[model samples]
Target: MKLLIMSDSHGWADEVVQVVDRHKHEVDELIHCGDSELQVDSKELSGVKTVKGNCDFGADFPEEIKETYGSLTLYVTHGHHYNVKMTYVPLSYRAEEVGANLVCFGHSHVADCFMEQGVLFINPGSMRLPRKPKEQTYVICDITDTEVEVSFYERVSGEKLTDLSRTYSR
Candidate 1:
């Protein structure tokens, strides 16, 4: 399966729509780590699996989500209660509690894709405002039977060559 991962959109539907439309065929599922700021019941966002960010108000959203996909356990959250803008400790602890094989979060607007203690941690950055100088970015995740290949892409230029691998096999 192919999944498009994004976060911290902050109500920029035009940019988000453009990115999804451009990569629509290439993605099987879309996941947002939070800060969409759209109407909670908006069907326009139905394609994206979203969490609630600190800025996300008046909506019903779970603080955390865990599910099984392929051969991996995925844990998704927005990281406000976890204090993601400050550190990764809270999230790391949550992973341990959930025994997650893959962890997805957003809050700091910094692109992060890496592995630690046999778990994949992904923060897809903010599509509205990227924290770094490169560009606003997201990730394309290809999951197979026992492996996951995550490729990062810059939204402005639409490049998918950057590989951010947090794991290879179970």
Candidate 2:
């Protein structure tokens, strides 16, 4: 299965819509890691799996989500509760408790991916106000029973960042 992951849109509805329309046909799942600032009834969020960030006010969205796809279990969160800006240790501990093989989170607005003690954690960065590398990024994760391949892409131009792409074996 392939999943499209993005976060921290911060009211950029047009970009979010563009991304959904661009990849809706190819990806099995679409995830927003929060700070979208869109209403629950908005068309942009129709089929998206989302969480609430610090900037999000309403309770319509959950703080975290746990979902199963094929044989993979995914845990999604906004990372503020766990203090992602300081360290991922807290979030990593939470993933262990949930028995998650994949953890998706955003809040730091820094795109990153890594594996720790058999669990994979990914942050797709902010599509609106990205920090660090500052490329307005998102992630495309291709998963199977034995491996996962992650490809990063630019939200505006839809260009892949091949240098940031990575594959991990299970």
Top lDDT hit = 2
Model 1, residue 40: distance off in Å is 1.8
TM-score winner: 2
Per-residue lDDT, model 1, residue 18, is 78
Which pairs of residues clash in candidate 1, taking residues 3 or more apart in a chain or in different chains? none
Candidate 1 lDDT, 62-155, residue by residue in tens? 6677888656788999988888888888888999999898889989898877778888888888888888535788888777877778777888
lDDT of 2 at 96: 92
Give the Cα error of residue 117 in candidate 2, in Å: 0.4
User: What lDDT does the true structure give each of the candidates?
Assistant: 0.81, 0.92
